[model samples]
Target: MIELEGLTKRYGEKVAVNHLTFTVRPGVVTGFLGPNGAGKSTTMRMLLGLDHPTAGDVRIDGRHYEQIRHPLKYIGALLDAKAMHGGRSAFNHLLCLAQSNGIPKSRVAEVLDTVGLTAVARKKAKGFSLGMGQRLGIAGALLGDPQILMFDEPVNGLDPEGIHWIRNLMKGLAAQGRTVFVSSHLMSEMALTADHLVVIGQGRLLADTSMADFIRENSRSYVRLRSPQQERLRDVLGQAGVPAVEAGSGILEVDGARSELIGELAAEHHLVLHELSPQQASLEEAFMQLTAESVEYHAHSDTGPPDTNGWAGGTGTEAVSGGGWGEQWAREQRKRKAGG
Candidate 1:
């Protein structure tokens, strides 16, 4: 299990990560989501001991990451798929990690086969494609057969088949009571893979809840009705004290009413209905609804051509600059260099 208590990170005047506190328990895939510049990458860096937090604490299995003798055996992470020596072969890469962490050399081949990269194990890292690099990174993460795994944008360069494989792989690991924490911007894939969600915005925690509850609470749910007898249906719903708004194309949408209830009402009124379906908001819609204000970048639609500022039909500071999040990182790096 991974636990964070009052975790915070600050670089000069900017708060990269606020006091975030959440528990990523075993036996389920907990998805991490946030808008651009929301401090997601910073938080992950701190969790893996890649960066020091300015305040608070984080632990893996009741111990700090630095204190663990063999961290790979306890918690494995894939923060950056391309973070490897380009000249090294995939097999050598995994072998080196295994050697340092006291993992068996034979386990290298097992993970290579597990990620379907056995054929390319002898190839140099620079020669591999993005998807192949992703598989190699995953193989390294599984080298120690750790109980907890964390992946960030694992499907960034994967094809459909690779995506499906990784999705099921994470589920299979969690089924064995392993803790799986993943961060991704692909809401559709996340909706399919994650059982729970941890959302943050502008370095602050916005939500930590089950997937179903998060969507239901943040989005509108309604029943869509389509009928040939539109007028009769509207009258029936009105008389029954259920408000329905017309949605063109001979369709009516009723809020706070179940499909079964509406179907029974139509039946009692002797009305002919063509469609009666419950419409729940999708995960993407729910995410937008919750983080609308927290969005750091904005794109505007206009009839004119794009402006020199790179933002379409807009000018001034309000326009989204190219250096959105990178500006913050550049400042942080400069501060570090000066302090050093």
Candidate 2:
């Protein structure tokens, strides 16, 4: 288990991590998520003692990492895949680490096989591709066979097959009662792999909860309806105290209203229903919504506003524009104050 108590890090005048406190228990895969510059990497660095925290403490299995005797035997981490010496062969790299940590050389081949890098164990790491480099990193982390593993963006730059492999490996490790904590920007992948989520924004804790609870709390459920008499339907829904927004021509998105009620309303109004479907916000959307202002970077399309044109036809788009609970609440408040 890993526990962080009021962990904080600051660089000059800017605070990178602010009094962050959380516990990662064993036998579960916990996902760490945040936007760029939200201090995720900083927090991970502090945990591994790569960077010193200005305040607070981090404990691994009831002991600080710096205080642990033979620390590799209890905790393992993959901070950077490219941190290895490029000239060293895969086998040599693992051998050096094992030797320094008092690990037997036999375990080197074992970990190489585990990461499926045995074929290229003799090859120089400089010749490895991005995916291969990641595998090598994972092998090094597993060399100690530690009970606690932390991987930061493990699936970045990986192909679909490699991504799936990493996902399964994390789950398998957690199944064996190991504490598996990974950080990633891919919410879709996290949704499939993580049982718990720890979200942060602007160096502050936004949420720490189970995956199901986080989704249920942050996501908004609504029904999209399209009818010939769109204005009439809007008026009817408004009169019924149902919040709605006109979503382009002949389409309306109704919130806090059930599909059954929508059907009954349509029937009573004799409206020509062209389309009606329920929509649930995705994890990616919730993440964006929660950290909109905390996003250090924003990508703008060349054409214009994103909603103007369906470049690839709605199939490739993500739900909720990175605005999570905080943004959603702020938007609601603004609307209410404006008499929306």
Candidate 3:
């Protein structure tokens, strides 16, 4: 297990990572997610002892990363796939890492085969494609056959087949009871790959939960209805005490209502229904919902204003926009007081 308790990091006047406290357990794939400039890479570097923490502590098992001799034998990391010397051959690169960590030269060949770089085992790193370079990096991480594995964007530069291969590889490792923690920008891939999630935003721990629970808590589920008789359908729904929101494209959205119930209602009213289906918000939607304010970098999009209902809520500064919960409550009070 990897444990971090109140882990923090600072760069001059800026706090790169806040008091992050979490445990990465074995036998599961834990995905790390964050928006741009969220200090995800900084936290990972601190875990590997590549960067110093300003305060707090992290441990590999019970020992600090620096205190663990032959640390690779305990935890293997692929933080940067291109961090190797370009002049060295795949085999030579693994060989050097093994030598430094007191791992046997024979293990180098084993790992090269494990990552399917045996054909290019003798090729120089500089001659390798991006995909090949990623494979080489994965080979080095697996060299020690450690109990804990950490990967940052392991599928970067990989083709579909390579992505599938790497996905199965991580799951297989976790199935063997190893701790598998990875970070990725691909939400769809992360949804399929991760069983657990550690989400951070703006250097603060936003959420630490299972993938299922996180999505469920952070997203909305609704039933969509469409019919040939729009006005009649709306009246039928309203009379039945079901709130049907008139959505765009001549559709109605009913929250907290089952599709079966909506269908039955349409049938009872003799309405010719064209469409009725349930929609659940996706992982990408949930992640963005939770991290809206924490997003450090902003890009102007033509998209409309965000739906601030679900888990996103609103920032404290949203009072300026009359969106914050406290501001809304105060506004309600003044209206009641002034008889507006």
Candidate 4:
């Protein structure tokens, strides 16, 4: 298990990571999520003792990383895929790491095979593609056969196959009772991979909860209704003490009312209902809603001309993608409404 308590880090006048406290438990994949420059990398560095925290402490298995002898045997991390020596062959690279760490040479081949990089074992790392590089990095992390593993953006530049492989690998590791903590900007991947989520914005902890709970708490739930007499239906819904908003022509978004209640009201009013569906907000939308103000950088258009298409490619677009950003979001939404 990894436990961070009141962790804080600063660079000159800027605070990189604020006073944050969270625990990543074992036997599950814990996702570390945030926008760019949210101090995720900095936090990981502090955990690994690469950078000293300004305050607070981080502990792995009840001990600080620096205090633990043979740290690699206890914790394995792939902080940077490109941190390896480019001139060295994949096998040679792991061999050197093993030799220095007292790991047997045979273990190097075992890890290389585990990452499916045995075919390119003798190839120079400089010639490997981004996916191959990631595989090699993962191989090195597993070289020690550690019980705790941390990966930062393992699928950043991977193809679909590579991404799938990593997802399964992480899940498999967690299933084996290992602690798997991975950081990524891809909410979609995290939704499928993580059992729990730790979200931060501007270096402050925004949430630390189960993935389902986070989405359920952050997303707005509404009942979607459509009728031929839309205006009358809207009035009926409003009179029933439910908040209603016009989602589109002949469609109303109703909140604070269950589907059965809405249906009963419609039947009582003799409304010609064309459609009645419930809509729950997506995780991407919930994330945007929660962190919209905390976003560190904001882009502005020049010439004072309004960019009408700005929202089209920005957060708005992300919110509309639905399952693309996180399948767990959509699944949870379905489960909530289906419970009715």
Query: What tens digits encode model 3's per-residue C-alpha lDDT throughout 250-314?
Result: 99999874888888989998999889989987887677656653432221321223333422343
lDDT value for candidate 3?
0.82
Decoy 3 TM-score against native: 0.84
Q: TM-scores for all candidates?
A: 0.84, 0.81, 0.84, 0.83
- Lowest summed lDDT over 10 consecutive residues: which window, candidate 4? 296-305
lDDT of each: 0.83, 0.82, 0.82, 0.82
The parts of candidate 1 lying over 4 Å away from their true place are 293-340
Clashing pairs in 4: 188-325
Candidate 2 has which clashing residue pairs, if any?
A: 288-322, 288-323, 289-322, 289-323, 289-324, 290-323, 290-324
Winner on lDDT (1 vs 2): 1
Worst 10-residue stretch by lDDT in candidate 3? 316-325
lDDT of each residue in 21-125, candidate 2, tens digit only: 999999999999875566888998888888999999998888877887777778889888998999999999999989978999999999999989999999999
- Per-prediction RMSD in angstroms? 7.2, 8.3, 8.9, 9.6
> Which is better, 1 or 4, measured by TM-score?
1
What is residue 61's positional error in candidate 2, in angstroms?
A: 0.8
Query: In candidate 1, which residue pairs clash?
Result: none
Per-residue C-alpha lDDT of model 4 across residues 207-263, encoded as one tens digit per residue:
899999988888878888878898888889889887678866667887743888989
Q: Which residue ranges in model 2 land beyond 4 Å of their true spot? A: 227-244, 267-274, 292-340
